[model samples]
Target chain A: MSVAHWMQYLPIEIYVAWRYMRFNLKQSFIVALAVGIGVSIIIFIPSINLSFFGYFLEKTVESNAHIKVVRELDTEARNRQTLKTLYPDEGRILVSDQSLTRRRDIKAYKNLVSEIMRIDGITTAAPYVSESVIIVRGSQTRTSTMRGILPEAEKNISNIEENIQQGSLDTLSDDQVILGWRLADELGVNVGNRIQLLTNFGKKSLKVSALSNTGIYQQDLSTILVTLDTAQALLNMPNEVTGIGLKVRDMYQAENLARLIARTFDLKTTSWMEDNAVFLDQIRMFRVIIAFISFLIVFAAASSITSILIMVVASKSKDIGILKAMGTPPNAIMRMFLLQAIILSLIGVVAGIGGATFLIELYNATPYSKAETFLGIGRQPVTLNLEYTVYAIFYATLSSILASLIPAWQAGKLDPVEAINQ
Target chain B: MIQTDTILQTIALTKVYEGIQPVYAVRDLDLTIPQGSFMSIIGPSGSGKSTLMNMLGLLDRPSSGSLKYMGEPTETWEEKRRSQFRNEEIGFIFQAHLLLPEFTALENVLIPLQIGRNLSPARIEHAKSLLDRIGLGDRMHHRPPELSGGQNQRVAIARALVNTPSIVFADEPTGALDSTTSRSVYDLMREINREEKVTFVIVTHERELAGKTDRVITLLDGRLQSDEAPKESPS
Candidate 1:
C-alpha cells in the first residue's frame, strides 16, 4: 500500500482495535493495567537508585576534588621501578599494591599538565598535594589527610568555591588553612582559630580561615585543605605537588579527555570514574541486577498480553474465517491483531510514563529530611532532576514495545481456518 | 490451451484423511462445468460434497490429484499463487453466510477487493456498486447483526462477487434462512448467474432446489452415484 493510503486507512485499524477492546473489555483492561504496573515498578526502583548514586557521586566530586590522579602502585616493588634484568630479579612477592610508596619528578608532572591543556577541549588544569598530617590544638591532636591545592587553579577546575559551607575559598593566606567541618569539630576548632599541624618534617602553627562541609563522611572527617605553596613549605618540599586535575567543557567527554592527556603527556592519567572503578562498577552492577528483577514483571506482563490475545483469537475465529474467505491475506489478519496489542500497550506505556512523571514531580516538591551522614553534615532534602525524568520516559517506552511484540507475533501466526473452527 | 467456455475443471481429484487407517474423503473424481452453468452436488452429510467445494475453492489441497483452473494444473501452485487464484477466479458463500460482525455492510463488500487489490478510489466505487446491486444501498453502513439473516447473506453475496470472479462455490448458501428467504436467495443467485454469466456450483441436500439446476450430481458415501441433466417434465 502507498504511504498515503495507509495513513488514510490508519483509523480503520484503530477502529478495528477499538472494537476488539470493547468486545473484550475485561481482558483488555487487565492486560493494560498489568503492563502499566510493570512499567512503573521497572522504572521507579532503578531511577531512584540512580538518583541516589548520582547524588553520592556529585557529593564525592564536590567534597574532595573534581578528579584525582595518583601514582599506580606496584605490588612487587618497594621502590618506584625495578631493574629486573640487571638485578636478576629479587623476585619480589607482595601482599598489597597499597603497601608501596613511590616518588616521581614534579617538574616532568608540570610539563605534563601544560601538554594536557593544549588539547582542544581542555580549559583548566590544577595539581593536588596530599600528606598525612597530625592536627594539634594545645594538647589535643588527631591525624588527617592534608590536601594541598593551588587556590586559583583549583577554583577554575571545581565547584570548591560554591561548596564552601562557611568562610571564603579565595581567602588563602600563607598561615591560613581550611578545615573540613567534621575534622574541626573533632579538634574543637572554628574559623579564625589557630592550630598546630605536625607533618613528617616538623610542626607548623596555622590559623583556620574556613570550615567547609562536603557531604561525604570520610572526606569531611579526615580532610584539611591548604594552598600548594604553603603545603610545600609545611612538608619541607619546596615545589613538589602530587597530581594534576583537568576541567573539560563536557562531563561526558571526561574519559576521552583523560586518555588524550595521558597520550599527549606520556604520564599516568585517570578520570574520576577510573580512579573509583570498583565503586562505579558496583553501581552499574546494581543497575543491571535491578533491571533483571524488573524484567520479571515485564515478562509477566507480556505473558498476560499473549494469553489475552490468544483468547481473543479463539473467540473471533469465525470473524477471521469470514475475512479470509473474503480474501484478507494472513498477514493483514495478523496485523489487525498485532495492532490491537500495540494500541493496548501504547496506552499503558503513555499512562505509566505520565503517572511516573507525576509521582516524581510530587516527590520533588514534597521535601523530605536530608539523610544524615557519618560526617557532620546536616539534613538536606533530595532534589529532582529533569534529565533523569526524560530517561525514565525513554526506558518505559522501549520496555513497553518490547513487551508487546511476542503477543502480537503469536496473534499474527494464528491460522484463519483453525481460528474459525474454534 | 484453455477454452473460455469452461470455467472450472478438475482431474482425478482426491482427498485422504490420515490416521492409523486413513479415510478417503473423495477419490479420483473428475468433473467439468461450463461458464454460466448452474450445477448442484446433492449428498447426505459426510458424502464429501463440502470437501469437493473446499478443493475447488483452493481452501484445501487434493491428496493425489490435480485441479486445473481454466487449463493450468494447481497441484504445484505455491501458497501465494493459490491465494491469488482464490482471489481472482473463485468466490465462496458458506452455510452460515459468515459475515464479519465487526464491519459495516459496505465495508464487508469492500473486504475481498481490498485484499485482492490495493484499494484505489475506483475499487471503493466498485464495492459501492456491488452493494447497491445486492439491494443494500441504504443499509451499507449497518453492521451484520443490525441486518436480517437474508440481508447478511446478501452482503456476503456482494462480498463474494466484489472481484467479479468467473465461478462461485455455494455451500448451502440459503441454509441459515427461512424457507421464503431461502427461495428469494436462490432466485437472486439464479438471476445473477443469468445476468453475469458466472458459473455456480452449489452443495445441498435440498432435492427441490437441486431439481431446478441445469445438472444434479448425487453422491453416496465418498463416491458419485449419478450425474444427470434436468429434463423437461413430461407434458
Candidate 2:
C-alpha cells in the first residue's frame, strides 16, 4: 500500500497507541531498555574492531615498505635440476654443468629505481642490502639483521628517522651505525659507543650514532641500521643490492601496483597485504564473528519486544473489542499497535546510541596502562564511526517492527463479539 | 428519496454453535424494527436474548437466512462495508460500560467520531453537548477509573449518542448500577429517544425496565415467546 493510504488513519492510531504506552509505563520502559542494550553492543563491537584494524594497518605500513621488488629466481637452473631428477644417468649426460650459486642480487637497481620513480602514485623508491651479523661490546655479543640503506631515500619510505630516540640518522657515516634501543641494551652499548661488527668477510669497529625504537618488539630487539657503503664493504659485495623498497600514495592500491610492476619489470614484487596475509585474514574473521554476535543480541532484544507487544495485545483485547464495536476497522487496529512498536523502537534506538557513545568515550578516556598485557596493544584504540552507529539503530528499529507484526495481526483478527463477551 | 419505514429486518435468521452436538443460539427468527422506536428485549439467562441482540446489531453473522438494513440485503456486504455502516448508522453500549480506562470521559465520548474519521471542532462541541445533556459536563475530564460506576455509565451513554446514529443497541446498560442509578439511566434513555428521534433497542432482565419501553420483546429457548406493546405508561 502507498504511504498515503497507510497514513490516512495514522493520527488516531498514534494517539491511541501513545495512550496505551503511557498507561503501561513500566512495561514500555523495560522494552526500551532492552533495545538500548542491544544497540549499545552492536555499536560498541564493530567500532572497536574498526579502530583496532586501523591502528594495526597504520603501524604495519609505517614500519615496513608499501611494496618490495626482489630479484626473480633463475628458471634455467631449476629446469636443469628437474631434468637431473627425472632421468639420473641420461639427464646428467645431456645437461651442461652449471654453477649452483647464482647471484641473489638485483642488477641495474639504481636505474630501475629512477625508472619506477617516474610512475604516477609512486612516492619513493629506495634500494637496500640486508645481512645477518654479530655485534660485540665488552665481550657481550648479539646476532641481529643489519640493513644498509640510503639515508635520504630510506627516510621517505620508512619512519625510522621519525622514531629515532637519540642522536640522528642523517649524520650516519660509513663507520657509524644506528642500533634499535632493545638491541643496544642487549649489547651493553650506548649512542657514541664503539662496537665490533663481525661479518663473513672481515671485522670492523663501528660507532653507534643513534638509537631508535619503533614500538614493535621484534624490530626493536633484532634490527641494526647502517649505510649502504659500509654494509657492501663489510660484506665484500660492492655494487650489489638485495631489493628495492617502494612507497605509494594510496596504501590499499599496493597489491595491484605490485602485480603491475612485477609484470612490467620482470621482478618478484610483494605488497604489504601479501606480507601480512594471515593477520589480515584473522582480522576479517574476527569482524564476521563480532557482527554475528551483535545480530544475535539484537534478535534477542527483538524477542523481548515481541513478548511485550503480545502481552499488550492479550491484556487490551477488551479495549480492542470496544473499539471494534465503535466501528474501528481491523487494519486500523493493526496500525495502532504497529505505531506503538515504532514509537518504542525509536525511543530505544536513541537511548542505545547515546549509551554506546557514552561508554565508548568513557573507555577511551580511562588510562589503562596494561593494554598491551590485556589486549595486545600499548594504547587504547577506539575510533567513533557514525555509519556503524546508524546501521545499528536502523537494524534495531526494523527488527522491532518485524517482531511486533504477529501480535498486531492477532489483535486485528480478534472477534469483536467474543472479545466483548469475554 | 425512497425511504423504508423499517430500519432493520431479519427473516428466519439462525445461529448455531457447532461442538459435540450442535447448540442453536438463535433459531429461525423473523423480526422487523421500525425507525425512531424505543424497544426492549427480555429473556432468562439462556434464552438467546444476547445472541439475537448481537445479530441485530451486526456484531455477529447468522448461520443461515437473510438480514437487511433499510431494505438492502446485508449478507452480501463485505466486513469493511459493514463496519462503515455501523460507524455511520449504529451505536452500541455494553453491560460493563467498556469505556477505555486510559482516556478521559470526553475522549471516550469522541471514540466513535474519531474512529469514523478525523474529529472536527464541530464534532468535539457536539460530544461536549452530549456529555452536558447526560449531566456529566463536569466529569468529562475524568478518566474511567477516577469516576464512580454511575458516572462511567453516563459517559458510555454519552459516547453511544455522540455519532448521532440512526439506532443504538444497549445490552444491559444499567446492569451494574444501583437501583436509583438504574432508574435515572432508564429515564435518561427515554428522554433521549423522544428528543433525538433515535431508535434504541435495549436488552435487559429487569421486567420493570422492560415494561417501560414502548415495545417489549420476550424470548425463550432460542425463539420469540412474545412481541407486544405494554399496556402501561410509555415513559
Candidate 3:
C-alpha cells in the first residue's frame, strides 16, 4: 500500500489508543511521571556540567594566553650524559658535539610573531621575557616571577590592562614596574612608591607604577611586570626574547595549533588545555558518568512503561478480541498501543523539560553567595541548553516505543476466538 | 441474470481437539446456507454448536474437508486474505454483546466500517440511522456500560449490520437478555434480514427461539440430528 493510504488508517488507531489512555488515567499518569523524572535527570545534569565547565573555561582562558611558544631547551646532551653514566660498558654513545651547545633564545622573534599571526585562527602574538626576581622594600624581601612585556603588544594577548586596580599600564616607563595587588601589599608599597628590584645582574630601584588583581589567588600573590627593554638591559641580553604568547579566535583549537606551531618553528609550545589536561579529563569523565546514570534512569522508566502496557494489554484482551472480530488488522492493533506509548512519552518529556528549566531558573535566581557555595563557583552555573532537552525527549520517545513493542505484538497476535471465550 | 443462491457450503467438515485424550468438537458435517436465509443451529451443551458457528464464521479453520464461501474454498487462503474476506463479507455478534466500553453506541456501530477504512460521513450517518432504527436514537452518545443490557444488544445488532456483510453469524446474541428483550432482538434481526436481504446464521440453545427461524438445524454429540422447518403444533 502507498504511504498515504497507510496514513489514512492511523487516525482510528490513534483515537482508540487515546481513548484507552483516557480511560486509565491513573496508570498513564504514573507511567508519565516515571518518564518525566528520567528525562529531567537527562536534561539537568549535562546542562549544569556544561555551565560549570563553560564558566571555568572562560575565566581560565581569559586570565592566561591561549598558546605559549617557548625556546626549546637543549636536553639531548644532558640525556646522553646520564645514559652514559648509567650504562658505561654497554656501547659507544653516538652523541653529536653540537648537542652540548644550548640555544637559550628565539632568533628573529619579531618576524616569527608576524609569521604566526598570518596563520588562520591566530588573533594576536606578543613576545615577552619571564624570569624570577627578588623585590626589596625597606626591610621586607619577597621572591616573585617578573614578566617583561611591551605594554601595547601585551594588551592584545592578556587582560592585564583591564585588571589593573590602580594607575595604568599605558603610562608605564622604563624605570617603573607593575605589581600584583597582594604583592604590593606584602611589600608595604603603593603605586608611585620606589622599590628596589634585584636580578642576577644587580639591584635597580624602580617605582611601582600599578597594581593589578586578576581574581586568582596565586597570580595576585607573587607577580611583577616591567618593560622588556629594562629587563633586557638588566639581564644584559639585547635584541632577544624568552617566549611569545598568542591568543586564538577559537580557544578549542589551541591544542592543535600549539602542536602545529611546535612542528613548524621547532620551538616548544604549550596550550592552556594541555597545562590543565587533568582537570578537563575529570570534567569529561563526570559528563560520561552522568550520561550513563541518566541512561539507567531512562531504562528504568521504560521498564515501568512496559509493565503498565502489559497490564493494559492483558486486561483489555476481550476488547482486543472484539476488535479482531470486527476485522481490525494485526498491525493496527500494534499501532494503537505504540501510539499510546508515544503520547505518554511526549507528555513526560515536555513536563520534564519544563520542570528542569524552572529548577535551573530558580537556581540561577538565588543569592550569589549561597549559589557560589553550592556550585563552587563565583556565580550561578546552570545553563539551559535546548539541544540537551531535544536529546532527552528523543531518547525518551525511542525508549517508550521500544518498551511497548513486545506487549503490543502479543496483543496483535492474540487469537480472537480464545480471547472472546476468555 | 440468475445468481447462485448458495452463499456458504460445508462438506464433511470436522474439527478435532488434541489433548490428553483427543475430543471431536465437530465431525462430518455437511451443510448449505442460501443467500438471504435466516436460520438457527440449536443443540444441547457439548453439542459443538459454538464450534460449528466459529468454523462457519471463519473464526476457526476446520481440521478436514472443505468450507466454501461464494464457491471459493477458504482452507487454502492466507490469514491476511481470510481476515480481509471476513471484514468485507462476514459479521459476528456474541452472547455478551461485546461492545467496546470505551466507545459510545454510535462509535460501536461504526466499528466495522472503521476497520474497513470506509468511514465516510455518509457511512457514519448510516450508522446513526441504524441505531435510530434499532430504537437507540436518543442513546447514541452513551457508552455500552451506561446502556441497559438490551440497549447494548441493540447496539451490537447495529454494529453487525454496519458493514452490510453477505452473512452475519450471531452466537446466542440475546442469551443475556430477558424473554421480552430477547423477542424484541429477534424481531429486529428478522426485520433486518428481510429488508436488507442479508443472510443470518444464529446459534442458540433455546428451542423456542430456534423454532421462530425459517429453518432450524439441531446438533447432538458433534453430529447433525435434524434440519427442518418448525412444526405448526404448539408444544
Best by lDDT: 3
Model 3 segments more than 4 A misplaced: A1-10, A73-104, A368-377, B1-3, B233-235
Q: What is candidate 1's lDDT per residue for A1-422, written digit by digit as tens? A: 23123432443334456767876788888877876776666665655667777666766554443344554323224352454443443444123322443454254457666776787877788887788888899889998888788888888777677657668878788788998888889889998899988887887788999887756677678868888877778788775676777777665567787776556555566777676678789888987787677667766877777777777776777776666555555666667777776777767766766666566666667655665452433333344445444544455455545655565555555554455445
Residue-level lDDT of model 1, residues B33-142, one tens digit each, is 78888889999998988888888888778898778887778889876677767777778887764877866787777666566655667777787887787788889889
Ranking by TM-score: 3, 2, 1
CAPRI verdict (incorrect, acceptable, medium, high) for model 2: medium
lDDT of 3 at A410: 91
**What TM-score, over all chains together, does every model reach?**
0.82, 0.90, 0.92
Report the TM-score of the second chain of model 1 against its true counterpart.
0.93
Q: Identify the candidate with maximal DockQ.
A: 3
Q: What TM-score would you give candidate 1 relative to the actual structure? A: 0.82
What's the ranking of the predictions by lDDT, best on top?
3, 2, 1
Provide fnat values for all models in the order shown.
Answer: 0.28, 0.62, 0.53
True-structure RMSD for candidate 3: 4.1
Give the higher-TM-score candidate: 1 or 2: 2
Per-residue C-alpha lDDT of model 3 across residues A278-385, encoded as one tens digit per residue: 979988898788778978998999999999999999999999988887788888899999989999999999899888888888887877653333222376558887
Q: Count of backbone clashes for each model?
A: 3, 0, 0
The regions of model 2 sitting more than 4 angstroms off are A1-10, A73-103, A118-120, A134-143, A185-188, A195-205, A215-217, A232-240, A369-377, B1-3, B233-235
The numbered model that scores best in TM-score is: 3
lDDT of 2 by residue, A1-422 (tens): 12123323446677799889999999899889998999888888777877777777777786679999977555435656676776587545354444443455776677888888888888988899898898889878888888999999899888778878778889999999999899898878899899988998997899999998877788889879899989888888887788899999999899999998888887788999999898789888987887798789988998998999999999999999888878888898999988888888889989998888888898899887644542224665586667778888789889988989999999999999898988
Clash pairs (backbone) in predicted model 1: A317-A419, A317-A420, A370-A380
Candidate 2 per-residue lDDT, tens place, B152-228, comes to 88898888888888899999988999999998888888898898778999999988888889999999988888999
> What local lDDT does model 1 show for residue A45?
61
